[model samples]
Target: MMITMKQNSRAPNAITSLDVYLNSLKVGVIVRTPGDFSAFSLNESYRQTGGHPVLSLSLRAASGGLRKDPKPVSKTVPAFFANLLPEDKLREAMEKHHAEAVRPGNDFDLLAALGADLPGAIRVVPSEGSLAVQPVREEGKGKARFSLAGVQMKLSVMKNTGKGGGLTLPLDDNDGQYIAKFPSTAFPGVSENEFANLALAEAISMEVPERELVEKSDFAGIPEDFDTMSDGKVLLIRRFDRDEGHSRIHIEDMAQVFGIYPARKYDGAAYHDIASALNVAISPSAALEFVRRLTLAVITGNGDMHLKNWSLIYRGDGNTPALSPVYDLLSTVPYIPADGMALSLGGERSFKALTADRWKAFAHRARMPEPAVLRAVTDTVALVNENWWQLPERAHVPDRVLDRIDAHIKTLTPILTSCANS
Candidate 1:
């Protein structure tokens, strides 16, 4: 029911105390804290809709008693959609795709081998989504846990809360609720870029959820000397996941619905069979098809896409699961000197060799015909090219960053078009 930890600045690892609750609740994951006295609880309520469960939850803020109003909070996608999948069957499908992507002499399994870290830094939260983080035990260390309006914030061991630093805070800004990500050094850097890419993808006609780039100045209670400053960076982003004032439908992540879900090649059988496997509303074929198009987007160098990066939001009396608006979009290929592919595109960590041939290979593996893949590729490229420059100027992306994106677009267009048409 409860767990405790002290600040340990060592290698990236989950606080061991979380193991007890993770073993017990079967849904929650526990994390670390900067100080003491941060607490929260997650109570999920499921209702049947169209033969699928529409999950709604109340995130109660409590330390000793009933704290904030226990309003029902819902995300975009239902996790049960993945629950219907059988692991072995999905693995079989993945094997087939792996065969297609890996060349005879290559020492890598492009579509199936790369291990995808959990999506966004958020899932680093306890699986159960409830937490009772005792603040860091340093003298004069204020309660690291704080809330603004109705949203709450907490720190954790090096996990991706998208904070670009270790301190992950939840806030109610822009009249909507969101989790602000500040990643610690031990985590990945592409986390911030992915959020930018989310914005780009949404603008390019990809359906994603509504999100905003939150600034540190926009947040209160943070120390003026907080170690967030690095390499001239001064701001942070907060993701809008909950509209705290209103009750909405909730759909969870694919992994949350099933057991430990692996992030592998996007073309795996899991993509095609998750709906039926999980017995949720999404059909395997449709889910795989959606992923096919998404894969093309990634290999074309949208490398910021990851597991938690993609989600299903609820609509229509907040009961049905639909993809959230694309947010946090940016071109990492020419930006970040890390990997060239988004997290696990068609399962490959690097898309440097991704060509028209590889595109067809990926399509075949996803069970989507090559022609459909071609069309989707063409459409996405056109949309990105048409809107790339226009969007950066208006979105939260800074001007210098926009110019770099513009230059990168020119460099990327040839590859994108060739692959799409190929």
Candidate 2:
């Protein structure tokens, strides 16, 4: 997987610029600046197009609408692109293995290296005069070129059908139809927790991805380094951003929607902010979806519903967006013991702080009817209560996690009853 010294030396054969694309539409070009950083220029025609994906909501004009200036970025790697790349050990592993290709300090190079298949429909390919993307390297290292914008060790995988069908990190040129997340030693049984949580969500009829819990051996082209989890299982989520035929359906998490850096995912903004944004830009139904999921988090003790965990999915040629399928729904109180809400609800950051007043404040801020808000809360509690017993007793979840969820449900049950009586 090593790149030759000639390409590293920039011997007139290294990638210097990249053509950014949304699906087949030309979006823009990213070029190296005089200061050896990066800058992006939006294609005038694309900018003028009524429904073109503008890469991110952050790029929209301050006045809002289709107008985009694409402010000249001066980072070693732009923040938008930086958010698209993995963080921490995942990034280090990618850089270490693809040393000759992608690297840190300048994420533009990294994006170019792995841009063939990226999140959403965004594709970044080397413009010319360079061979940034090399042939399929030995082993599965070549498949590591795809990117997912989080600190977690995640992979985009393609699923097989018929016979002994399983998932594989495709060595050929196709985006993963499913996103595979492995179990964490730091937080054991996270996959199981998410599987159970998603089961509840599906039972409630909330929009959610098709999910499966499979063994690590289920993967066909997984790297040897990641084969440590012999008995451990992986969670496979059908990619919502891809169509039935596997074409890209563009998406941007609220973090990308707000133009905030990934480090600030937990900082700044609250649930009210999300509701307000969804009301104005997306739809009232999207905001209602937020309420349903937020209620699920409160009752399940899932305290990590940060901005990055919520997303807006763009479908068709229309610029309209909808709340994306739920993901990362594991209960955090099991691990943190005292875990609460990731963002404040009505300005409170505690699970015990979820009261009638908070729901009133949240509905007031979002400009939704209080009865509608109350209905969402009551329905969520009812759905989980009804579905809990239906989940398999041997759901692969840890006993402590189940106990925590039961406690939250008990805590919320009376509250819902109190509100109904009042």
Leading candidate by TM-score: 2
* TM-score, cand. 1 vs. native: 0.51
Error of 1 at 310 (Å): 1.6
Q: How does candidate 2 score on lDDT?
A: 0.75
lDDT of 1 by residue, 1-422 (tens): 33233333211122221221211122322223343112223322111122122332222122412223222213211122122122232233322333333222221121112111112111222223223232233364432222111101211111133545343322211121343544324323334444566666666656555444344444444533232442222223333334434222344444443323333323333432332332234444445446444643453355655443345555544434555544434455545545465433344455545556666666665566677666666667677767655655345544554555566556556665686545
Clashes of each: 66, 0
15 Cα displacement, candidate 1 (Å): 16
* Tens-digit lDDT string for candidate 2 (98-190): 666554545776777777678888877666524455433665355456778777777888888899897877653567888888888887788
Residue 310's C-alpha lDDT in candidate 2? 93
Q: Which candidate is the best by lDDT?
A: 2
- TM-score per candidate, chains pooled: 0.51, 0.89
Any runs in candidate 2 off by more than 4 Å, and if so which? 1-14, 51-54, 62-64, 129-131, 134-143, 160-165, 225-230
